[model samples]
Target chain A: MKTITNKKNILYSKKELGQIQLLLPVILVVTVFSLAPLLRGIYLGFTDYRLGDPISFNGIENYKQLFSDEYFWNSFKIGMVWTFVVTAIQVSLGLGLALLLNSKVRFTSFYTILILIPWATPPIIRGILWRQMYEPNTGAVNILLTNLGLISAPINWLSSFEFVIPAVIVAGVWGEISKAAIFLLAGLQTIPNDLYEASKIDGAGLWDQFRHITIPVLKPVLAAIISLTFMWNFNTFGIIWVLTQGGPGGLTRLPMLAAYEEGFKYGYIGYAAAIGNVMVIILSLMLFMYIRVQLRERTES
Target chain B: MKRNIYIVLILLVGTILFFLLTRKNNNHQNIPLRFVSLAWQEGTIATNKSIVNEWNAAHPDIQVEYIQGTWNSAHDYLITAFETGDVPDIFHYESSVIIDYAMRGYLTDLSPYISSEMKNDILDVAWATVTRPNGEVDGIPFLIESLVVLYNKSLFKKEGIIPPTIEYPWTWDDLQSAARKMTKDTNGDGVIDQYGAGLGLRNSANIIMNTSISFGGSFFKKEGNHFVVKVNDEEKKLLQTIVDMLYKDKSVSPASIGETGAGMIPGLFSGRYAMLVGIGSWGRQQLVENAPKEFQWGVMPPIKAKTQTYGASTQTLSIPKKSKRAKEAMMFIDFMLSSKNTARLALNDWMIPARISCLSMPEFKDKIGGWDITCSAVSTLSIGSWLGAPGYVEWKSRVANPVLQELFAGRMSIDDAARRIEHESNIVLSRYKKRGEVW
Candidate 1:
């Protein structure tokens, strides 16, 4: 009777205790691998730490310098343009493709696998491939553009100040849209056919069905992708590094690239950490507000 | 139960055999040392491995393990190894790139390991490359390279231009005119079909900084017994000449400014480029290998302005500070740099050996691939002012490279480039200065 009472306790139960035990390993792994490094990075932000040099606590000295750093501000401004532009394109196009795949169409599964090809490719490889295509002399882009009579002379896409950002954005959108589409497709599958059927019975048309049923059902997945991809895009380094090396000039030098240059190339580990900390604070505040808005809408609905 | 017993018996036997094998193999009490060699080319890799094998066979008591490393990943690997206290016993790298590591006390000072004969045999220019301002000899330079102009023999003949010899190399003015004289539109297209010269300015920072020595343009200068970042019109001379060749004369292509030396090879062989200036000496070896059988090429001696000289960018071998068997590792380095062995390595790598005795090797006298010219230019090599300077790497990559690139590309005016380079370089230097404490 005592064992049964223990299992039946409202505050704590044996079954619930067993579930928590199953999660202990996962919790430990996350704490050790992810949480510890993040916390250490934040702590290092307050110290003057260069590679192979002694570390000392310098309070907000790095941050004070960061405020006046023209390079840092330039990177942040470019990163904003890159992250928001890539996220907006990835989500909107992804939803359209997700809707097309969710309907009862032939070869839906085959097309779903095809949609995952870009996502399956690694970011560095994608950068290299896109770089080759953007090469001036013998690139496929130049060849295609020539055939279409768009321009006479070949333009060096990656080396030009005018065309580099849009060119890199196109490459970023290509590599990331598949991931967004796959997640939204999963959400689309959960929307029952009966919801659309009930909407059609209420004299709803196609856009009406989408506006009333599909939009609300896909909101959660959109919110997740929006905030998550915004963060991921802002922190992107490898692809852009391989693509332009933030160049023609520093036109595409994202904040992550600037931090990497400082930490690895310039050996200012503390300064890099400070940049990362500032980025995290801004991202976290935005994410908090987004989640709160999401929750409020869920309750109102 | 019977199957379980069989498995236990097999496991017991395996454990006993493993211990017996290890115990038997531990008979030789050899002190192991690791040599991290960054030799990537096919010929150089073979030579390096063979040298290590010879060292291992000749000294059974001191076993030196050969760990292959790549040029691309060497910097990151060494930094991590030093920070984690897993330093290799010996390593090979360039002199300038290791200045930071030496300054941070990761390198063992090799002054004690040097023999008078060995010290006297190598050129002072090479030794000066690895010597710090405080006279700490952190490494031993074994090979040296200088800038050379690789030109097409056929085009020089076709244009009736006298190919510059080592005794009378082209002056900067001569090179500019020769470029203009050779540039032509063979196909009658409005676009120039054959560019006269390719500068290979992709690494223009190192090339220009070194070449600037001929014009007496030292990026750093002495003030009150200390070095400060100083850029003026003297420093702008070489870049301005190259820019004029690019934009004013229209003899060199803007593409050459973007392309590396290796990338210019295709243009050189295809008759699209007549001369490639400011390329390393190793480029001649690559040209010999890739050029068509009938296409003849010759390397002009180092070009001149006020004087004929190039930066003594030398490759070095250093031991880690924390190595237990530093003496043994230094012995291996010493043996590897013997006159005969050094000649063999330099011959295969197409680099000039730093040891003066190694220059007399019969292979260097061969006219093929302009060996005679390259060996003759050895006298012109000098120690660069930027050697072992703090924050030099940052300034080179950030200020000098982009400034030259834009100047050659006709994007930025010379004044703006110079002003930005001076302003930005001082900012980079000021961080490494002795403030209240070490930063």
Candidate 2:
């Protein structure tokens, strides 16, 4: 009796074919809606395309101009600072809330539902709410601060160079914290009670157990959330646009805002696309590093 | 259950496809046109809707629908719409943007479509706004605003100051000193409760470019062929004046410096600003609802600096080149800008009509709500030098405006601003030279 010694299957089996057919609609949608535009945007980055004008190949001229552009560099630096600050604040605070909610407490379910309210709000709505609340004369923030004797004069939070980035970061974090919190909460739930119980019997303190058990187990979830938050915060446009329009001397001009202004406002379509392309490359590099690190860590463990 | 869901989804898809097919089959004959309007005022929106309704009722063959738009993102919206060829057939935009669109060749040169009577009706200066360098009329100029300094009459009276008139205009220095004198520290607080002047200097380029002629600053110059951004001394004067109001005089509120014309209303009503430097329409139209009962505000007559002139960036109507119904759209524009309709539209908008005949209407001559002041200042409406220059928008947003904002915010020195303005503006203007537009 001879066994069929095939190392690989030459054809998609009947079930595999069915699975692919089931995914056909999704593949079609992604190709048409997302992939097409993405490819078009990338192609446009290499051309000198102005609004309603004939497009011509210009090689890497747009990228060259971007390299020399002081405003572009400034916006890039601002975007980095914004992304870092927002992601850091959101993750730490979100983890803290998750931990508190996971603890045996009163109305934990009710509090979890209440925390999700901000996640449902649109970014532009949050921006408008924050802008109104930051109004110098009648804004709730200014009124409350003044009543509490925090400062003598009202601070123009959205306009001042010193405060604008921080203010927007606060607003950005407010609308996004629940997303991180929920993910971390789910990861926490998946953690085994036996591990904590064993740690307690071993006379391990809260910090020791968290550092050894929670850190090791929640590493993958943390990696995913951190990467996602970083990407989202970097590409943010709506809240900053509505709140500042990259104004007060462009102290808050993120790369996305700069791209928007260049493309829509100034009609420099190719240049804007070039900016977008550069952002994508930077983000992809960061993502690639994230995956590599994750793989290495998994191998080590 | 899953199979049932899939069948239901198929039915939904079929229904949608059926509806789309039916819509395409039956509506091929009467393709309706869309008119996007940036009329946000309650009265203006109502008037715009009724005008469209009246046209739709009259023209059974060529139907036009009104699409309400906001001024906040009008330029951004139009740029995308024009790019995607999804624009409304007739769009209400400013001549500044129309000039930009025309420079890009996005607009239909309505020269042949414009009627002779309509051509003769609109003033030459107003017509010149949307006219290209080659004399192609890209749009119909319909409404122009009169620049006025609206003052609190009660505050002026309390200060015992005489209101300046068009005949006896205030000198630049007089206006400055008056503003300084009016700034008061009431309620024994160290902080000034009432600012002397609060100017809506936001859209710094718009304010500076439009009013720079009044300060003898043309800002833009045509050198040989391409337009050059000139910021030596004349342009610096206007920006310095704004900066001085905020810093040197300390009479203008820092917050108000970044507000729009309409945004200055709350401060004006609350007496945070005793005087507001803005356009005429803000006082005439926007105040109808925001004003306190019997709130007496008077237009502080014109100010004379180097020349008592300001640029008139008229709100205009233009047809997109890609619009299939260009001829019908032109008809709608003509209907919208007729003598009677223009007058009604201008009255409702609280702006001066671009049509020459509409200026003589009895309503425009009314002394109430500063209509007399508004109508008289029409003579100072100079054709903006920045209108035809595509490079100007880029230069303004990138170089001139940010510097002016920083200067007004008291974050940058005047010398530093001047250096940056010239150095950066020259770079921008030189970059646009490659576009071959000015040439």
Instruction: Give the share of true interchain contacts found in each model.
Output: 0.17, 0.57
| TM-score of candidate 1 on Cα atoms, chains taken together | 0.91
Write candidate 2's Cα lDDT for A95-191 as tens digits: 9989888888999999999889898899999989999999877899999999999977788787676787778888999999999999999999999
DockQ value for model 1: 0.24
TM-score of chain A of 1: 0.91
Clashing pairs in 1: none
* Regions more than 4 Å wrong, model 2: A1-10, B1-29
Which candidate wins on DockQ? Answer: 2
DockQ of each: 0.24, 0.53
| Prediction 2 TM-score vs. true | 0.94
lDDT, candidate 1, B319-405, per-residue tens: 988776789889999988888888888887888898989888778878987889998888888888777677777777767776666
lDDT score, residue B41, model 1?
Answer: 60
